[model samples]
Target: MDRLPRLACSDPRLTRLIAIYETLAPATLGALEALFAPQARFVDPFNDVSGPAAIRRVFEHMFETVDAPRFEVLDAAIGAGGGAFLLWNFHFQSRDKQRTPRCIQGTSHLRFDEQGRVLLHQDHWDPARQLYEGVPLLGGLLRRLREHLAAR
Candidate 1:
């Protein structure tokens, strides 16, 4: 697999945020309050919520559902007007005895507040291809549907 080139970033807040993501764990969930604004909004394919508490719950649920879930920041860039983008790969294992490992590639768009805390964080990724396509029965069905829908 080709690796993405990591971009150099000078912004301290963006650097800190990236570090937080790369090192995230159940013990570090408390750090969200410092990284996000009181009313920050977080949106992903599965959850859409506002505030640090709600965002914490989202991560909490992830921890409960998966084993050893972690994020690998492949590349990051700061955008104009206090915005930033992060390309990341999420790695985890299923909770079952087999513990099948999975990886999901995604990107996050972040807008920072004046205080350098995240005001909005939106994640973009394809659930059908990255997630559901790996399931047993569902995976086969989705692959068949995808083949059927493709241009011949």
Candidate 2:
């Protein structure tokens, strides 16, 4: 919430994050270390990575099959200070070519430390759409059914 970027690429910390996302989105293990303190904690529904080493492990395991990672920053707003959230569309290819380059839209909430390095990096997205639904066979259909019930 603090240390908001004025532009998606302006802040040094944000820049590092974007650079990592561009090159390592699916498999960015060690690259993340540069963004956080040695003991920083990162939490997502799938993982609660504590410390740099564990976070790196999560990234390494995540990148196992995801490839050709690319990001499209659709919209952003620069604040008076040094931070911002860019609505992003993350597209990538999986080893399962049948469902290659699936587009998953998400938001990365990043903050900077006093030194302007990323202190907190949080992400928000629909796990169903970005992940579960992208699986093969009944994935999409199953997601639809879940959505249908949730709407009730």
TM-score of every candidate relative to the true structure: 0.92, 0.69
Q: Residue-wise lDDT of candidate 2 within 57-146, one digit each (tens)? A: 767666665776666665454455655565777777877747566777777665565776555556677887668876676687978788
Q: List the pairs of residues colliding in candidate 1.
A: none
lDDT of 2 at 138: 68
What does candidate 1's lDDT look like per residue over 37-79, in tens digits? 9989999999999999999999999999999999988888888
Global local distance difference test of model 2 = 0.65
> Which residue ranges in model 2 land beyond 4 Å of their true spot?
1-8, 25-29, 75-84, 97-99, 136-141, 144-152
lDDT of candidate 2 at residue 83, scale 0 to 100: 53
Query: lDDT at 143 for candidate 2?
Result: 82
Candidate 2 residue pairs that clash: 4-82, 4-83, 5-82, 5-83, 5-84, 6-78, 6-83
Model 1 lDDT-worst window of ten: 1-10
